[model samples]
Target: MSDKETPEQRRERLRQEEIKNNIGGNLNDSINKSNNGNLVDLVGSLGWKGTGILIIVIILGYIIYSLFFS
Candidate 1:
């Protein structure tokens, strides 16, 4: 199969590629910052583990409240 892109299609593809590269670069920068002892790095580094713990604590608190009061 032969595939050819029109000029407009090529331009759009390049634009999309640039956008993806920019986002990836920004993410890398944030990770690097976090690795260098920045407090904001805590969030970037811990990420889902921190988020999961927070959710679990909240759920447990809610359950305890319901069990004790109602």
Candidate 2:
């Protein structure tokens, strides 16, 4: 088989590749925005004191659980 593509085929391939890249970029941007929004809401709700308490509780719970169960 010939390993050469026609001009029309090459143009079509490049166009399709461009479209694929654009769609992937747009999807990634949207996902990043969504994740950032969730993070913002979580931080806002927890504030500083709540976050600190949560971390301490989680660490203590982990230690207790590991000691008792695993």
Candidate 3:
């Protein structure tokens, strides 16, 4: 993260970052398979009515925040 890092240090940092990302991706894939596809599974469990209400609430919250802050 520092500008003073040598090339070897940067390379090793990137290698570690890639390893972490690969492990995270594998874990995410396993979880998605078990949970039946992440957001799709969530919306399905909520059903149409619950999903609609969620969207409405999110939109209203955004609008209220914008009105007050911006």
Candidate 4:
């Protein structure tokens, strides 16, 4: 902010400040995107407990669908 700062430096500093201010939103987006990766990565990230729950839900859904519609 000093008068001694060059224009390019000022621009770069402003850009960095803006990026810092926006980092919280970016972090949340990154976490959400991480879960949306390929199937294997998503499952691995969730670990065994999450994988078990996901499989249980799928099996229950299939059972209900077969009973009701087929």
Error of 2 at 45 (Å): 1.2
**Each prediction's Cα lDDT score?**
0.62, 0.60, 0.65, 0.66
Q: Write the per-residue lDDT of candidate 2 for residues 14-40, one digit (tens) a residue.
A: 755654456545344444655767755
Worst 10 residues of 3 by lDDT: 23-32
lDDT of 3 by residue, 1-70 (tens): 9999999999878855654456545344544554756766545444455457768989999999999999
Q: Which one wins by TM-score: 1 or 3?
A: 3
Better of 3 and 4 by TM-score: 4
Candidates ranked by lDDT: 4, 3, 1, 2
lDDT of 1 by residue, 1-70 (tens): 1168788888767755654456545455555666676756644443455546656987999999999999
* Model 4 TM-score relative to the real fold: 0.49
Which residue pairs in model 3 clash with each other?
none
Q: Which pairs of residues clash in candidate 4, taking residues 3 or more apart in a chain or in different chains?
A: none
Q: Worst 10-residue stretch by lDDT in candidate 2?
A: 42-51
Error of 1 at 37 (Å): 20
Candidate 3, residue 36: Cα displacement in angstroms equals 11
Output the number of the lDDT-best candidate: 4
Question: In model 4, which runs have C-alpha deviations exceeding 4 angstroms?
Answer: 1-36
